[model samples]
Target: MQTQSVQKNNVHKKSRSSLSVYLGQWNAPVVGYVFIAPWLIGFLVLQLWPIIQSFYLSFTEYSLLDAPHWIGSANYENIAKDRLFFNSLKVTFTYVLASVPLKLAAALFIAILLNRSIRGISVYRTLIYLPSLIGGSMAVAVLWRNIFGTDGFINNLVVLFGFTPHNWIGMPETALSTLIILSAWQFGSSMIIFLAGLKQIPSELYEASSVDGAGPVRKFISVTLPMLSPVILFNLIMGIINSFQMFTQAFIVTEGKPYNSTEVYALFLYKKAFGSLEMGYASALAWILLIIIGIMTLLNFIASKYWVFYESESGASK
Candidate 1:
């Protein structure tokens, strides 16, 4: 009985020691995780859960009022057959292709100007960036509508310049273009990025080029473009992704009107989900958009190997 009692005590001591050591090993990390538990729970519950649920819903016919019926790939198949889907794709692609380059160009130009050490530069930058700060808001969309409508700012300007007054937003050909211009108008974020990129470039390169009898334009082409390529590539990918998801202005300013010339993909998905109560179809569209965005991002990454230049890599290669 004494031996048995000793054995029991030893076993209990070992178990306690093992548990204490284990707790000691993980104490800091466990506490750290405890502190972050709320964010983790929120991410899992709010963001990840919904994403996974949406993916599953894409495969099923789910109206909020009814049970989710297993429909397999019928939703995806319907997306292919739907005519408005095609129109949405066309309009979205047009907006992306048109807006991105113009926006980048405008941003780069503004960034170059802002990079200069001139008086009231901060105020000018703030004033210029003010449009982007208000961009995509309902107020901005309404203001944009007013600016391009018949008897609006554009028409009034045209009349003042001795040209016939015209409705910029009323015509199908020009409607999408007006939105593209609006997209370009919010070039502030891209401009800030370009400004940062410009600052990263060493002044010595400019000096070296100047010594080699290169003019400002030539220096910009040789020195600026190659160094700034990485920033440009980043901005391009982001712009493409953002442009694909455009909806607000299309909904507010045009409502996909003027012969459906501005029926963007996101607006179509939104209409499917809320407007038509076809949640399953909208989920399918969302999945399709994910695939498209994934493909575009993949393509950009693949193409980046050729165009995106890093100074460290270039220096090492040289």
Candidate 2:
């Protein structure tokens, strides 16, 4: 009887202890949530609400001055028929396609070079990264515009080389190309990511490749490429997304000038929203952009299975 009683008491104690531990764990999560409540609330109020409202507004005909009237896909239909819309879409797609690959390639190349053991390497990294921090700013956009202007740095360089100075910014053929170059100039962030990915690659693999009589190019192709595939994939996605959403530089620099040569989708949307006061149409455009980005991301994920490498997972398994 005494032994049974003692055992029961121990069981009761264990149950209480377990309950206390569970409560403690629960309290920590609650406290953490409480701490993060402000940010959560802000995201819901600012981002989530705006996204939901925009989706609803897309089906309507709304101007800021008046109540929205539901038009039932009229905005989407109009967008299909709109010449400017198609032009902007083409321009935006061109920009994204051209800029992202070039930019990423430049970044990866620079990253590989900088990954070597060199004196004051940190300074070189900082210098390269500085452009990314500044390139997206209004000031930098203005500077770019000036540099490409008729009487600007580029034209002056042409004059020095005994060539006739040409209008750079005012020319439709070259204006968009200038923007592409600008986009490529800000490759520092991608380079940093590539550097990080390079660091994660094991040095032993390189040694093994060397022992197998693999040259630099062969080693890069066989070992480095496979190991860095994941990072390459990441940079590709991010670069594509960012390029698709490019706005500030074009907005400040060209303002869709030279016969709409630089008129990207985002700028077109902005013009519709604020300039023409077509809120509903602008909202539809936003939704379309969101859908495009989603589709692209989905496609990338699907394609990644064939190329992207996981440390522990086989390609066939993926």
Candidate 3:
């Protein structure tokens, strides 16, 4: 009886060990997929599905109340003659052209200032980044509206300086400028990215340049700019994309006021999608915007080959 019981126990242990080994083999192959299942499902359901639907709907007339009807390229044809479409595109292009460069410049400048090794620098960075955290909020938009209003804080400051208080948001010429200024002010994200890039730059390069009697301006031009070009390209593309899609501030603060001077493309798309219920037209616009962004990004990549220097490429070439 003892011999039989001991053999039974050994068999049980062997079975358990074999089972565990099989499970380990299976888990090794499937664990990564299990972890990524949520993201994959989300992409398929929330993003890829919507993108496909939008592309299909862009070719059809899909009012919310009725079934989508096939319309071929009529929407695109109509867009060709749509004055507001042109206006919104013009405003968006102008905003992208102006705001992106300004924002990147400001971010780079602040990053350079903040990159020093000093006490409480993190606190300073946090304080500066705070605005960007709340920058897109409705409250911030309202606050910005008040600041640029005729009798708001900015006007008070102008009065103190003996300059006449002007309605910044109410004017066509200056309305977009205020939005651009706000965009530039929310440069904290770009600044952080620039700081990261700056940290990655080899100090040996700077030392070598310094030893060669390079001045501050010379070192920056020779050493800093070349190494930082990739970061600049990244920031530039992101800035262009964000600036082109700017809507909340324009919607809440200016409402594309003073003869639609500040009417950005996204705001126009919003009006078409929700306001007029022209879902098909809006989808077409969205796709067109996507195409425009893709082209711009492609152009940036083409242009980058001329200016963007990679350390790996340099090493490989040498």
In the range 26-64, model 3's lDDT, one tens digit per residue, is 865487888899998999999999999999889999989
Q: How close is candidate 1 to the true structure, as a TM-score?
A: 0.91
Which stretches of candidate 2 lie above 4 Å from their native place? Answer: 1-32, 315-318
| TM-score of candidate 3 to 2 decimals | 0.94
lDDT of 1 by residue, 1-318 (tens): 999999999999999999999878886978799999999999999999999999999999988999889899999999999999999999998899999999999999989989989899889989999899889899999999999999789998998999998768889989999999999999999999999999999999999999999998999899999999999999999999999999999999999888889889999899899999899999999989999999999999999989788999978998
Candidate 3 runs further than 4 Å off = 1-32
Top-TM-score structure, candidate number: 3
> Which is the winner by TM-score between candidate 1 and candidate 3?
3
Please provide, for model 2 over 1-318, each residue's C-alpha lDDT reduced to its tens digit, 9 standing for 90 to 100: 999999999999999999998878876779798999999999999999999999999999999999999999999999999999999988999999999999998999999999988899999999989989887899999999999988899999999999999887788998899999999999999999999999999999999999999999998999888999999999999988898889998898899988999999999999999999999999999999989999999999999999888887864576
Per-model TM against the reference: 0.91, 0.89, 0.94
lDDT of 2 at 28: 78
RMSD of each: 6.0, 5.7, 2.1
Q: What order do candidates take by TM-score, descending?
A: 3, 1, 2
Candidates 1 and 2 compared: the better one by TM-score is 1
